[model samples]
Target: MQHEHWWPRPYRFDALLAPGVARARDCAGGIIVVKQGGVPAPLLRLRHPHLAAVVAADCHHHVLAWAGGVPMARLAGRVPVAAAVRWTGQLLAALACLHDAGVVHRDVTAANAMVVGTDAVLIDYGLAAPPGSCAVAGTPASTAPEGWRGHADARSDLFAVGVLLYRLLTGRHPFPGPPFAALQRILHGPVAAPSTQAPQCGSAFDPLLARALAARPSDRFASAAAMAAALDAAQAAFKLHCAANGGLARVAGECRKNGNRNDKYRERERKYRV
Candidate 1:
């Protein structure tokens, strides 16, 4: 069952090309992986590094992406609302490309994405499948409830994105849990407005995310483009409100307190924050 989902093994790629295999002298987090794969290094040159086909000595020695960046999870409660919003746009853009290709990235979580410089790249396509191959793929916390019982379409990806965005902006997951508890939370938990947890998010931001995180697929945004537009509108509204209220800087202070921590403000203040 586990192998069923393994990314194509290195031998699969090796038949076409072989890469020199070298093991890292040291391992991170106390796990050392001696690599074993037949795919020649040249083959990787032709493939996207993140999706490269390099099998490990065991079953999990897969190396994903040649780049390193901070996982958004580690940046929780430090990401400002504005910074979160900016990242959301980039994520949506990446999804648009996937949806255009008729694929659904079944799994999209903070662990699956990394923030580098000012942009975020969506990673971990091992579970990405065409529409109608529901099969319950993806992290439990991020999976759409319908995925457990039906085919998850593009909207399903949007739902996962919504979950991510919510966490990014609020620091707290709309549904929190370890496994069964988290699944139950996703299935039966409350969808509180983002503002409730992070006032910096502003009330306008809540409605848009609410629709994205809606339990019912039909209740969510119709598409990634729609979600992006709604996000843009919310940002505009927030800006106007800030202008009228006379305290635009206040939002960043609360972000420091908690509520999806991020620090985009230090770069250029509110112009592109969130």
Candidate 2:
């Protein structure tokens, strides 16, 4: 996430970028706009000396730019499901790229998954631990079960991704609690499907969200790619149901306008079909 901010004292650009810290150069400002890096050296730095691919630079990239998109939570109201689903792909692709580069993103929430010109870039490595490292930084609710003790791993990142996925769909965190409370719930409470919290979402999507939030890392989708594939399938089903029902609903409304007595039956069918 590039921002209009200045570097702090003791942290210089040359020193920052030397370790291959991820940065964004602002052409307009004629300077590097944002940089995310940490500790000069450790037994192994989880996020520092970070390796990341620049998926997108501008704010217009990714699903957030889709037509009729919902405002980001921090921005305003809920965004359309279509836009959210579209952006889900970008997040998956970004994760794949990082893993391929031999890096594990410790943070993978909606906040870090910023949309840049219709592209989503994984940002904020403050708590990122190197692959297989025993260091972790990220919100407790988004952190994996093993992360409570500062264990960062590929699966842990996936867990955070799952939390993000759940939030995108329901507009609420599955585990809602203060830092300590949320962490305790995540460490002890059973995973709840989004449908369970928001029954309006229907049963079709609950399992996928549940699988993503599974307590056992192995039980969750083996990788972000797998989760994406599963979400793609669920989204297909959701769209199909909507398309079929939407057309019927419109016809029923038309029948009502014409004062057709039988329109009541059609309305029922439309409701169930949709």
C-alpha-based local distance difference test score of model 1: 0.66
lDDT of 2 by residue, 191-264 (tens): 67766554334455677777877777787787768878987888776666556656434533433443332324
Q: After the best TM-score superposition of candidate 1, give how far the Cα of residue 215 lies from its true spot, in angstroms.
A: 1.3
User: Candidate 1 on 1-274: residue-level lDDT in tens?
Assistant: 2222244333232221224322232223222112332222222233332232323322333433334567777655565556777888888877876776666878888876678666676655556667888377778888988877768889999988888888876777888758888788677667888788877666878888878877788998888899999989988887876666566666666666653434554653433354
Residue 91's lDDT within candidate 2 is: 69
Query: Once model 1 is optimally superposed onto the true structure by TM-score, how far is the C-alpha of residue 29 displaced, in angstroms?
Result: 23
Local lDDT at 25 for model 1: 24
Cα lDDT of model 2 overall?
Answer: 0.54
**TM-scores for every predicted model:** 0.73, 0.65
Lowest lDDT sum, 10 consecutive residues, model 1, at 25-34
Q: Among these predicted structures, which one has the highest TM-score? A: 1
Q: After aligning candidate 2 to the native by TM-score, how far in Å is the CA of 22 from where it should be? A: 13
Candidate 1: stretches off by over 4 Å:
1-65, 257-274
Q: What is the C-alpha lDDT of each candidate?
A: 0.66, 0.54
